[model samples]
Target: MKSVLITGASSGIGLQLASDYLENGYRVLACGLDVVKLKAVLSHPNVTHYAFDTTSVEQIDQALGQLSAPDLIILNAGNCEYVNDAQQLDAALFERVMSTNVMGTVNCLSVLLPRMQAGSHVAIVSSSVTWLPLTRAEAYGASKAALDYLARTLAIDLQDASIDVSLIRPGFVDTPLTRLNDFPMPAKISVTDASSRIRRGLERRQRVIDFPFLFILVLRIFSWLPVSWWQSIAASMRRHSL
Candidate 1:
């Protein structure tokens, strides 16, 4: 069987994808911070579970050091925390989000890239929030924005080596991550739908997999607007959400 490894496999979309991939007959290497949770969620004969904080490269290296490379690697682990007050500019909050969502991915990539070879695929979970600015998403949006560029650049650089990179950008996936939102989430999709679409896209080796067409279409349309115009729209949303 082809092998697939997924980070953030303890809960949310990660757990869902791990389950679905295992069902589809892939040997799964599940990674997360919680050992017990990973063990309980992916308790299959073909699934191997590892626990390590994503932010620490040492821990990641230690965890992945001895493993044979999986044919597919999904770097889906991330954290989401909003900036409640932009005027205050919470450095700590920004760092917390960046460390997990940005540096954490980088930490994993540092060790994992060598294991990827020809015919290997790597998918990174970025957010649709990167399509346009959102109210109170300074930290979250910026982190995903970084991933957007990282994935695209990797695609270009890795092409000659025959390694494929896919950027997974979802609009309001209804996972545990989105449950923390206080404002209304338009066009939220269930984890199952999210997993199905993502799998189909990866199988095709699509460079970008954006879900819930209508929602992303709206964002794409607004993305073409003048900066000032979009800023006005964002300000309006901030007022309503606040």
Candidate 2:
């Protein structure tokens, strides 16, 4: 049986993906910081739980060292917090968001890269925010943009190793995370749909898995607008949103 490891399996997209993969008969190593939550979300014989703080390289290395490398590894553990006041510039907030979304993924990659065998697949969960500059996405957008670049760079570097990387840029997945958003989310999809798209894309060995056709299409269209025009549009959005 093929084995897979998914971080953030305690909740949201990660949790849903864990259940789906397990139900489909894959040996799943559900990695999350909360053991109780992981168990509660995924309580199956085929699932094993590994708890670790993704931001800590020590924790990731020590935790991952205990097990054999899986055929697939999904680095989905991340956090999002918008910049409430852009003028104030919250350094701590940016650090917290970057430490988790960027460094956390790096921590896992550092350890897992050595463990990966030929034909292994690794996926990094980025956000479609990289397509267009949205209001108050300072910390969140920057981190995901870093992830997008990192994933693409790795795709080129890891080609000779026969390990594939899939960059997942999902737009507004309906989860506890998105539920906290004060603004409207267009074409937001359920966790089930997100998980299904990710699974199918990975199965097909697609390099990038961007979600919810209409949403991504709109973002792509907006991406073509000149930067000056987008700035004006974003300013209007921020005014109405606030």
Candidate number of the best lDDT: 2
| Model 2, runs deviating above 4 Å | none
Give lDDT for model 1: 0.93
lDDT of 2 by residue, 1-242 (tens): 99999999999999999999998999999999988888887899999888899999998888887577899999999999999898899999999999999999999999988879989999999999999999999999999999999999999999999999999999999999999999989888999999999999999999999988889998888889999998999999999999
Give me the runs in candidate 1 sitting further than 4 Å from their true place: none
Q: What range of 10 consecutive residues in model 2 has the weakest lDDT sum?
A: 60-69
* C-alpha root-mean-square deviation, each candidate: 0.8, 0.7
lDDT of each: 0.93, 0.94
In candidate 1, what are the lDDT values of residues 1-242, reduced to their tens digit?
Answer: 99998999999899999999999999999999989988976799999998999999999999998787889999999999988888899999999999999998989888889878899999999989999999999999999999999999999999998999999999888888889899999999999999999999999999999988999999999999999999999999989998
Output the TM-score of candidate 2. 0.98
Residue clash pairs of candidate 2:
none
